[model samples]
Target: MTKFSDFANTLQASDIAELLALTEKPEVISFAGGLPAPELFPIEEMKQVDQAIYEKEGRQAVQYGTTEGDVPLREEIAKRMKKSFFVDCEPKDIVVTTGSQQALFILSQILVNKDETIAMESPSYMGAIMAFDPVRPKYIEVPTDDKGIVPEELDAILAKDDSVRMIYVIPEFQNPTGITWPVERRKAFMDVINKYDVVVVEDDPYGEIRYDIEKLPSLKSMDTQGKVVFLGSFSKIFMPGLRLGWTIANPEIIDKFVKFKQAVDLGTSTFGQRQAAYYCQMFDMDAHIKEINALYAKRRDLMCESMKKYFPKECTFTYPQGGLFTWVTLPKELDAKELMPKCLEKDVAYVPGGIFYPNGGNGNHFRLNYSNMPEDRIVEGIKRLGEVLTEALAK
Candidate 1:
């Protein structure tokens, strides 16, 4: 028998993946996947960009490019970042990634060695948790409130423990919870980081998807000490199929990421990068995002309203200003993980909240994504989920 590397043992299958598989069933109304609506994908626009890139550049469009990513796309990303997030960086400071997902993996690779610590919110993005887990970092769940990660709590944790090297956060329309950090909290968070030697990974995938309020200034914008590494993605605002995202950091850090990225996949798809760049030049992304935001806002409103009507009085959920998901918290006696199959029986599915926690004890909460479904489906799914929850609460 051949012996397998111990690395394989560190990776456990994702429960979210298992839950999302229910989406394959036609009868299953799933809020489990944080997916953009298929109807909203810019198919015709992408077709034009694809043809233009191929016709204009020929083999160059498809050829293997630099590990740092396409210059044009990076410049475009830089411009948008400056205009929106208040962060300024040249194209050279950017490293294009296959997606923001790859950026997270790369950060884990570079920042975390065995037994090193990285702190994140108590119920953070599960995808990020999975990325960091394989590196075998000691996971610390920082306390968070409606405003975002508590600064004093983070300071206390960092002060007592020197093992912590990275602080990962999703301040704008944070995944699962749909919570955005207030400006004061963002400044306080940065002030705490400035006091320490820790690096902050600011993931901003949903920053542009706001429904009502204006987007807040990113932590990178407030970063004065160059301790912030920012990751942005087209996956939320633009189509995810393009798989284009970028990382912005100081040149020294970006250089290391470029070299590390070269070893991972050599480079991301050149054709994809060129096509995205062409599209960015030719199209109005902000206007397109407005259309997306309008669609999702309606769906979010419908879901929240339905939850209000259908869920038990004891149950509560977040009202997202802008983002794909809202967090649902049930009464303490209820277990969302156990309630899942019951909800599935009623042809509705959700991501039980336990998996979102790094250490995995919270089971009375769940996350519902309203972006993937139509308004009617969102209403119906929440209605069914509400029935399940009410029944569980009664029992």
Candidate 2:
């Protein structure tokens, strides 16, 4: 009774979504979603901003916008890029999309052909993999370390394969792993990427959420060859309900995105764009972000300390400097997927890490998010998780 095409057959349900479904249970303590703390959201400020937008420009806010996006929002985004990423760019070079997720999908449409290769970090963002699935690109996994992707490994891979059209990387507070790249590695990556003609998709939704380290320069900032396509999102820093994100690339590349986006959604939400622009213009966004960083830092420390106190010596996890997640690598003989039901029975939940891989074979790993739960929840959840992990190791 199914009428779905082969293209539909290629897609599978995401593990992130599955874990998020578990989060809705009242008794469950979920470390599964990489969601920002609801307490940090500027609800009162947003309410005021909404009132102001309608009071002044209600018609324009509700009306359809240009495919390129609202001029003021684009201009504001370009300014923020210069300060944060250290890149000198004009508003014309940016294309506003529904979310950075859409930017990924649009880029996949514009750049990939059937069966062409895309070099990715071994445990990359599952959302990006899902976005690129319909294109059916071949994947080559490049190894990563505590300092992000290993440049030499990437160099060796790209050197032999000219068929790779793109190298997708998440250098800043990367999803799942929560590992950040150092300046040396970022420069080294650029050195290798410049020699080749492939595009580098820099998906950085958590770049600004640092805990106790200096900010590293973005790969896009060092991209003299125009090989980096930077994807920026407000979902992590701002509210996810707004669904505003952008693509920063060369003007020519942005032109292609603009055209394709026209066919996709015509434009991102006009009211949301205007409301976001007004809020940024009137509020101290830096101060708001600083408050958020401070709160998440406390949660991260609590989770790490709890793990140290409770987890078995055989289990090791990353101590993230910033970002929402911590990647745990269990003993090789154990399977994270097989451990999930046991965790759920303990009234706790986490994402099994094997799903982060495009080809899906690494079963000894899993990802945990510290941003959603409060300090008490983080401590108790990790304690419960520790018990689960210890029991698994014993068996």
Candidate 3:
């Protein structure tokens, strides 16, 4: 007899990885993976952090530590958030996690059950939904536009009943959509959610990567009331391998998360947190980030221009300001999955839009990442993607 329960049989593989494995094509270029620009990682600076930490705090560097996270690093994160995100947070309000993804998962575990309702945007990040789905909560999809989620719709969802416990929102350079909510819209959302008892999760992994326009204040900053749980990641701006991300919230929420963090993994890597602290204190993170923004801006420009020049006139795409992705809406009749086969044959890869939706409904949209490809490669990739797109819509 099988040892596992019936629940184990219902589990499904992550949709993102499933498609990747299914494609199995040799020359793979994944717009699907939310990878940061690896070229911009500060190799020399990281090496220096490792060397200095080992020289001074050698034994502690290798051994286990507190679950709340490295005190100095938590302090540094507090400083950075206060200055950059405009959220008036102290070290005690934060819980450092292995990654922001873990923080989100933990939040779902703590908040949701088979009965509680969680409000999410219609086409939110696939990873967030997958994390929530296994827990089997009643999910309600909030409507969205080019400016991100519609505020009135969110108001209705949150006002419904106590069953709606929390909401997951990606306010800036959101994954898949490549849309950033305006400051005014954010203000409206803050006003609405504050009135209701529902909690809002503001996931901002891509907040710092803005390029074309002036940076806007994050929703966390606008939260005059303690209703928003602000999550930040070092993966995009610093390095993905570090897997460092944190949640800043009121003490009640944070204390619970910290206790849970102790149970989950007993804190993130010690060397990782120490090195991150060292990197922030010594090196110029702003200078490094500026270099990243400039380079990604160039890539976004190249991709947009390439699509305009080479793609079929019917194909449309979003002009993202700061993040890596550029959301594209293919011709109405074209199926993104069907086109992927041809796209892969041409050595270009992109995610079909269907996967981003909570319902797994069919969609004509897809997401592309320009930061990984150089200008020349971007041009060639778009040209190749264009050829497949043209063929798909030709009939």
Candidate 4:
């Protein structure tokens, strides 16, 4: 028999991963993965961009680059940080990561030791939990509501637990929940954070995919003490296959992060970095994002409308102002995980909500993603899901 490290021994296929595999069949209308619309990918523009890189930079385009990442891409990201996120940062403050996924793992490794507590919103992003799991840190789920993480609950948690070293949050278009913190809540949350000495990992992958709400100031923008580490991704706005993301932090954190990342993959793809940089220089990115926003908004509306029309009266869900997902809560007696197999029988699927809660037991909720499905599929899938829910409730 083979032996493994304790952390390696603890690894098992995630419930989400298993569920996603089931949904991979051609007939299944899956709302499981947080997938962006592939139809919108700039394939033709990328061909031109690739040709330009090879023609202009030759071997340099594909050569081993600095661990800090491509300078021009970092500069462009700095400009985007100022223009879109309201955070004024320079290229020096940024470190290009493999993806925000890698950043999560490295931050957890560097910032926390075993048994130290990491605070997160109740029923937070499961992927973050997976990333942090390798460190074997204790997790404290701060109470969260429609507006986002409750400040009073977080303040009390922080005041009582000095072991809590880091707090992870997705302020805008939060995964699974689709909740955006209001400016007042953001300020109040920051005030509480200012009183504590913990680092805040502000993951904002879906902030740019807005539909109705005005742009809100990021927690990083309000970070006066350099306590916030902002993570940005090109996946939602650009291409996920490129596997590119960036991190902005205090110089000390950036230094440690770059050194650790050097050990991880040497650096993010050199040619991939140039692809994003050249594409930004040559094309209208804002216009492309606007196009994504329009399509997703239509899908969101159709899904919500279908849910309203077909779902049982006891079911409730969020109509997100912007972002890819709508969070649904079933009546307390019904478990989403239990209902999922029935939905699969109907050739439709959604992510079970129980896995989102680190400490477990919010089994009545499920998350639905609208960005990857067509309008007809969204309507048809919801109708099937509603039937499953209605049948489950009847029992």
Candidate 5:
């Protein structure tokens, strides 16, 4: 028999991973993944971007680079932070990460020790929970509403628990819930955070995918005390396969993060970094994002409309202003996991919402992703899922 470390011992196969595998059959219309539309990938433009990298930099383009990542990519990211996120940061404040996923892992490792608490929204991103679990930290789910995390509740929790070392949030187009924090909530949340000594990890991967609403300033923009660490990703707006992301933080955290990342993978891909940087310099990234927004917006509207038409009146779901997913809540008696088999029988699928709650027990909800499917398929899938929910409710 083989022995593993304590951390390794605690690990188990993810239920979501297993569920996703089942949804992979070609006949099933899977709304399980937070996948980008592959049809929109800039494959033709990337060929030119790749040729430019090799022609311009030669061997240096593929060689080992500094742990802080490509300077040009960091510089480009800095401009984006100021322009899109309303956070005025320079290149020196940024460090290119492998992906925002890696940033989550590293931040948890560097910031928290075993048994310390990490505060998160009541139903938060599961991937963040997976990243933080390795540290063996206790989790405290703050009260969350449609507006986002409740400031007074968070203030009370932080005041009572000095062990809370970190707070993780997704203020824009959140993963499972697809909720965006209003400006008032952002200010109130920041005010509570300022009073506490904890570090805030603001993950904003889908901030640029908005449809109906005006852009709101990020929590990092309201961060007066250097307490917020902003995480950005190229996966949603650009190709996810490139595996590129960046982090902006206080100088101290960035220094520790770079040193820690040096031990993890030496640095993010030198060639991949140049690919993104060269593409940005040569092409209109904003225009490309506009195309993505248009397609996803259409899909979002279609999915919500279909749900309204097909779903039982007892069920409710969010009509997200933007983002890949909209959360659905079933009647209290019905469990989403229990209904998965029926959905699969109908050649439809969705992720059960319980897994999104780190501490568990919200089995009455599920999440649907509309960005990856076509219009006809989106309508058909929702109709099938509605039938399943209707049957469950009738029973």
Candidate 6:
């Protein structure tokens, strides 16, 4: 029998999907997976990209491209990012990645070491945490409120520790939480980091999904000292199946990420990158996103109303303006993981909120994603969940 290394021992499987895998409960409406609605996909636009890809760039799209990424695709991504984030940027600052997941992997390689520590929000994105866990760094959970991470706490931590090299953040409509950091908070968060020597890996996958309001400025847009390395993905807006994303950073770090990617998989799929580029340029992105937002907004409205109608008054949840998840906190004594089996038995599944915390500590909370299911399913599922909870608490 071969023994595995200490590094492999540090990684554990994520429970998000495992809860869903237990049974195909017909009545199960899962908020376990942070999935986007398939109906929102602009399939017709993608078909255009498919045709254009073969007609215009078939040879290049199919063949091996440079590890740095295809130049034209990178340029398109950069241009769009600059307009969206309202920040000055150049094509040289971008590196197209296989998914935002790969961007996390490359960053883990570049910035994290076995002995170093990463400061991150409590109940942050699980996928990001899981991506960095295999590298085996000390995980420090920073305290964040509905407004976002407390600046004083972060400043105090940074002031006390010289060893803290990196801080991971999801500033816009964060996964599991669905809490967008207000502009003033983004300013304060940026202000504190500006004084410190630490680096911020800004995650912004859901920034563009705003339904009720205009988009907020990104951390990278406000970054003046070149201290922020921003990550973006096409997964939420377009389709996760494309597996396309990009990282924006200083030339120095972009070079390292590019080199790390070269050693990892050489480059993101040339076809995928080209496909996204085509979707952006040729498609009616504004009209497409409007339709997506309208659908998700309706779903969100239904869930909120259903939760209020069925859930106990003691249960409180965040009302997200955009993005997929609604973070719910039951009574302090009621454990979320403990509630899982009962909820599943009732055929309603949700992600236990503890997994999102880098240090694994949010036991009373659960995340509900309204992005994937139909409005009828959303209503029915929440009603079922309400009955289970109502019955359990009465015991």
The per-model lDDT (C-alpha) reads 0.89, 0.89, 0.85, 0.94, 0.93, 0.85
lDDT of 6 by residue, 287-386 (tens): 7777888889999999999999999888999999898899999887888888898988878899888888777666889999999989888899999889
Residue 340 error for model 4, in Å? 1.2
Least well predicted 10-residue stretch by lDDT in candidate 5: 11-20
What candidate 3 gets wrong by more than 4 Å, as runs, is 14-18, 22-26
Q: Report how far residue 387 has shifted in candidate 3, in Å.
A: 1.0
Candidate 5 residue lDDT tens string, 1-395: 89999989978887667767888898999999999999999999999999999999999999999888899998899889988999999888998998899999999999999999999997998889988999999999999999999999999999899999999999998889999999999999998888879999999999999999988999999999999999999999999998999999999999999999999999999999999999889999999999999999999999999999999999999988888999999888899988888888899999999988888999999999999999999999999999998888887
Q: After superposition, how far is residue 303 of candidate 1 from its true place, in Å?
A: 0.3
Q: After superposition, which runs of candidate 1 have C-alpha atoms over 4 Å from their true positions? A: 14-16
* Candidate 1 lDDT tens digits, 74-162: 88988999888988889988888999999999988988888999999978999898888778898999999998999999999999999
Which structure is stronger by TM-score: 2 or 3? 2
**Model 4 Cα shift for residue 30 (angstroms):** 0.5
Off by over 4 Å in 4: 14-16
Q: Which model scores highest in lDDT?
A: 4
Local lDDT at 325 for model 1 = 95
Model 4: lDDT equals 0.94
lDDT of 4 by residue, 140-208 (tens): 999998999999999999989999999999999899899899999999999999998999999999999
Candidate 2 segments whose C-alpha is farther than 4 A from its true place: 12-20
Model 3: pairs clashing at backbone N, Cα or C within 3 Å: none
